[model samples]
Target: MQEYADPVIDWLDGGRGYFAKKLYRESCALQPNGSYTKDLSLVEEDLSRVCFMDNSPVSYNWNKANALPIEGWTSDPNDEALLDALPILDSLRFTSDVRKVLGIRGF
Candidate 1:
């Protein structure tokens, strides 16, 4: 569980960080154990350090166009490679977001 903490925190602090917030709410619903509860709080703090909305003009234009930037998007290849090595993180983030939306409407 401790070994899972850092990856979870990083995923929560990534592009789809909002999924972490939704996961936290769901975990709280499950009545998790002490260690899991502690991890959640720590991840929450990490999430706080992440900026969800990009206020830049480029970001605004991209949002309006419903497209993502292809160039100069990633600054760290090593970090990108590291994330690529952990494939489950992407699934986890997506699943959490879907779960959150479904949970909201009692689906």
Candidate 2:
């Protein structure tokens, strides 16, 4: 998963390192017993400060209030999903708790 995500993340940000952390199936988010279920609390102690984006709802099962669900990216030239989300992402950075905005927006 890390190998697959690295290129996609690079392409999205042009290797500028926009993402502070990258967690995958093999990351600390995984259960200590080696289960696949993710509990993001392991990766970030403060759920209020995190906004996890995933195409799969199951991925954010443990933290639905803090999720920012996005459609899976295809190579669609007309795709503007990310573009549409920029304003929210940008504004949330200035807020005290991201979950407050996410919840209010019904994300």
Candidate 3:
């Protein structure tokens, strides 16, 4: 994690772990067409078991079926996007194939 993520993290319980290494990847599709996305393949994790959440839908361009959309955070005290996503994520924990679930949800 970078210095930008430090302050907010210090407020949550065990927040540092949430920002642990391998939690994210760099942009792989930065082009004139404006698809600034991250390729999940770079993470080397099993796609079947992986579900990605991002505020920007384009980040899911490469593997959209596995995408989980969340609202962008702006340090708003009233933000509840993460809370809204918890149930879906909780169900994902027991999924054998994340794509199937996300696909059914129309992601």
Best by lDDT: 2
Tens digit per residue, CA lDDT, model 3, 1-107: 23433454454325545422243334366758866777787664678877777777877788898899877788799998877877887787688988887888777
> Candidate 2, 47: how far from true, in Å?
1.1
lDDT of 2 by residue, 1-107 (tens): 57756776677677776666778886535556544555777666887778877777777877898888888777798988777877888778789898998887886
Estimated TM-score per prediction? 0.19, 0.74, 0.73
Which ten contiguous residues of candidate 2 have the minimum total lDDT? 28-37
What is the alpha-carbon lDDT for the whole of candidate 3? 0.69
- Candidate 1 residue-wise lDDT, 1-107, digit = tens: 22433464566457744443433323432233322221233334532222222222333231222121122324454545344424433343455332342233332
Candidate 3 residue runs with Cα over 4 Å from true position: 1-27
lDDT of each: 0.33, 0.75, 0.69
Worst 10 residues of 1 by lDDT: 62-71
User: TM-score of predicted model 1?
Assistant: 0.19
RMSD (Å) of each candidate, 1 decimal: 15.5, 3.6, 3.6
